[model samples]
Target: MRFSREDLARVRLSAAPDPLWEVALSITKLYRPNVTEPYAEWAAWTRNVDDLRVRSAARVLGSLIPSRGYFPDFLTPADGSPSLEEGIDAVLRTPRRKLRANLGRLGRLPGWAQGLADGDPAALGSLGTAMRTYHDGMLKPHWERIRRRLEADRATTGAAMLTGGAEQVLSGLGPAVRWRDPVLEVDYPVDREVHLAGRGLLLVPSLFCHGTPVSLADDDLPPVLVYPIAPGRDWMRASAPERQLEALLGRTRSAVLRAITYGGTTSQIARRLRVSPASVSEHVGVLRGSGLLASRRQGRGVVHSLTGLGSSLVAGDDAPWPAVNSAQPEWCRPTPPPS
Candidate 1:
């Protein structure tokens, strides 16, 4: 049981957890250092657990081999003991030419990248037509983005948990991490356990966002979270409010939201809603002028969407919002019978 009766009682106290939950967890694990609690390892380890493996990161790498990088005649163990670092390096350090050559081998027009393509390809390939097309085409740029993200991922406590042998090869370049010292301080119903070295300090900025008190740590880079618990106290607390909020955002249907949600820029939103381009533009303009929506142009045709207040109303929330959705557009929407 990761949670207790008393801990569970305080779960709903947060109004709006400022930091992300992963940031919260990473902070807790690094500062508090929980050793006992029967299931700690499983709890932390599962974050990167290869379960969702629609295509493992390696698979993503393999896909771009022919076009982006050179595959060394290297064979490494897939199991836990071999060290995750070696595995990643194998993918990362493979000679670029080899990767490009290998890519040339497979479905040159491969519908399903040999499980090694990183990010989106059709989007990346437009940038070039090189020997290491996918790698140069897709993976390399994504890796740069990924590298920066990994740095942020390693910032809070990414150092200690060496995924493979990454730390061994790049000593000093390793992540900054430490065992939690006693006398931990924390925010309750916490999305993450805050772990600090020593303090009656009463103030340590949240690791992820220095400006805000830490909420939770889900680690954006390699996508791992840390949990800090002193030898005991294995209790579960609902994560920071933002996690739920993000999840809600993630689940939100953008197209449906456009049609049902209200705001501005009918042309921009209309393109998205798949309704008559003009009709979408007209309705969005109405919503905006009527105070049912708010919008800002993000370059691609002054985009539109519902206002905060508007979304709540459409979401069935009574936060005093104007009706954003008009009669659903006729093109894709179900037709109503004549009165």
Candidate 2:
């Protein structure tokens, strides 16, 4: 993708994961489970879910999103609302002309889908209901892990930005993307180029988008690049806190570490773990002192986040400590926790 000076300045990473994007991308993964090795456990569990409503909903979505090839762009709006309900509302409110144009790309449509293409109110309502049901069944159970992984990716991106700015953030977006000054080349299934003509780009990290990064087929729409994220080693397991980590760090500290996987202020983590802010502060100090955490001021509060060491430890990796950089950027250097 080619970017102008204004585009570069306007590039922004999503603060949170896009629910509709995940919902749409996840449907693709479900059909091609063999290609998604990282999601094997999730695939197996999803297949065995005995909910009839979920199965019915999946069938409805499956017809729209093929295992490969074009799915309608209306499913994932560029300005995806923060909540799933709002996102679904956005999908349902797609202009009739836009819906026809997007769904028309699919060529021949099924009898039921014809209603959807025609902007029938009942069909639109059904689509909204199915999306809500499918999300609750498949994605909701794994949403926390998804959110945490995205947060970790954002933290890494934040560090990259601190070190080198937007260019660094683009370059560090994994091997699938190459940052070559004005143009960012991506490994896409099709030969295409997006000219961000001062409109900028929204870089969204997704849990379900595997292999190559995805962009909307229509260049006229808002520019969004949804790329795959690396699911940590412990992503597919049950929701129990790691006993081994707890044993090593003791219960409160371990809980504190896990809570900060999504990064939070003192009161935020304290509220999450149901502990007093003072106790959380004490533990945060120890963790930061040991190089397992990093704290930086954000407005009135200090936001605590896991360092690479803390992340590796939390993920249960036995990797050696990362080498310390002698010339770390000022922002990359750790800040003292807020007084």
Q: Stretches of candidate 1 above 4 Å error? A: 1-99, 102-279, 289-291, 295-305, 316-339
TM-score of each prediction: 0.21, 0.75
lDDT per residue as tens, model 2, 7-48: 988888876668888888888877663644676666666766
Q: Could you give the C-alpha RMSD of every candidate to the true structure, in order shown?
A: 20.6, 12.5
For each candidate, the alpha-carbon lDDT, in order, equals 0.30, 0.79
Tell me how many clashing residue pairs each candidate has: 59, 0
What tens-digit string does per-residue lDDT give for candidate 1 at 218-267?
A: 21111111222122121222123323433543322323343434233555
Per-residue lDDT value at 130 in model 1? 23
Quality of model 1 by C-alpha lDDT: 0.30
| lDDT (Cα) of model 2 | 0.79
